[model samples]
Target: MGSGQSAPTERVFHNEIPISFSQDLVNRLEDNLSTPDTTPERQNTLDNHVRARIQAELARLQAEEVHVREQIEAVLERENLDREKALSGAGAGETEGGREDTTSGNVSSSALLQGDLEEVQKKVERFHVRRQLDNHPKVKDARDAVLQCYQAKTNTPLDCIDSVEQFKRSVAEMERQFVDSLRR
Candidate 1:
């Protein structure tokens, strides 16, 4: 009506209009989608996916293990240096104790070095224990299995009963083995 062109239609709603398709085509699609997923090809695909995921997890754990090992080695080296310093300081004090002023200072410094060495040894032991646990195959496998179960069960750990039971069994077995080894 304006300048010989049709007027724009008045907008009724802000929502987008849904696309339409032929009902026959939609029915065919639904039928195809409803087919069972128990085919051998699908099973193999799932197996491959699981294998890839396990490999990725293993790689991540190995990297963490290496980093922890490096930290342990560094702590051990520092502990050794502290030990050497304390020994040398004690020797020097024995030679120089004729001067009363230096005797007190050397004793304090030696005590500090001994404390530092003990702290470093504790840190190294903690890292070593963590590395051992991380490298345990049963622990890793149980963790992975439980994680996968949780994912499959819609992020609910409570639904992973079998996995939790298996984990407990594995831990019990490990404890028994450790006890037997200790007895030996």
Candidate 2:
């Protein structure tokens, strides 16, 4: 022992564990730890499940699309059939009361009646105006008669022809129409 120093520091001992270990011990401890599951395997399983669900939804939507298309096609086909039936003159041969709408045939008759009524009304009006201009005292009475005749024939008042010139012009036009019709 050295002078003035204790013979030796008392040695300490512990049985729980050593403060440091060998490199091999640490390596062995790490190797004994359980490994985690593989990332690729777990990912693959999840991907397959997602893919199946997506495929099912796609199939369902596709079926709905097909159904909608079928309904549209059906409506279009019905419209086409109706169009074909109408274009083929299917309604032409159908008869009612021994006739199929003679409205077109009555046009000539109606025109003739209209022409006769107009001509008669024009003659009555011409006579009335001529009588009025001839210094007749019954001008008012003649005018009233002309007005009644015009209203009865045309279902219109005599307000359109306020002068003899207008009436003459109307008569000339009517005569020209009649002449043309005769020529035709």
Candidate 3:
């Protein structure tokens, strides 16, 4: 910059919330909806699920925001490196009239960026979500309890407190197990 003072640097913030948590939450909601029985609890659950989904979506957006900022930082770093190379090259290749030529440096940097973009596009084309295949029987039992309570206490969803607690415990236990497995 031509200014005497330096410009402020951009700061990127990262959220440590695992995206998998939201993914599993969505999967469980879908599983619950797969049941044939319709009850008032299901409606309430659906409403709650919708709210959860909105929150999950917000989290996903935040992740994307972080990713974009990281990409921008990477591009800026590359540009700085390219600028340094170009300046050095221009100095070495100065003409009799003191004109600096940087065509080669500019071309090479643009080509490098193009190659990177193409490689990224190729990887993106091959991307797919990995879905969990196994369903734990313990979780199945807890889901049944919640489902039963929903059917029985259609008028008063608060009656499903015990079942809901059990379901929460089961899911939390399963999530712990899943994370532990990944560590191994």
State the lDDT of candidate 1 residue by residue for 16-91, as single tens digits: 8787889999997887689855569889999999999999999999999999999999998887667556555654
- Candidate 3 Cα errors over 4 Å, as ranges: 1-134
Give the TM-score of each candidate: 0.32, 0.29, 0.29
- Quote the lDDT for 134 in model 2: 38
lDDT of 3 by residue, 1-184 (tens): 7564677778898879855558889997888789766679877999899999999999999999999999999999998886767655644476654534434545445554666578668655543211241377778899999999999999998999999999899888888876665443
Q: What is the lDDT of residue 90 in candidate 3?
A: 46
Which regions of candidate 2 are displaced past 4 Å?
A: 1-38, 90-184
TM-score of 3: 0.29
Q: Look at candidate 2 and tell me the lDDT of residue 29.
A: 72
Name every residue pair that clashes in candidate 1.
none
Candidate 3 residue pairs in clash (backbone atoms < 3 Å)? none
Question: For this target, which candidate reaches the highest TM-score against the unseen true structure?
Answer: 1
Model 2 accuracy (lDDT, Cα) = 0.60
**Candidate maximizing lDDT:** 3
Which pairs of residues clash in candidate 2, taking residues 3 or more apart in a chain or in different chains? none
Task: Report the poorest 10 consecutive residues by lDDT, candidate 1.
Answer: 97-106
Model 2 TM-score on a 0 to 1 scale: 0.29
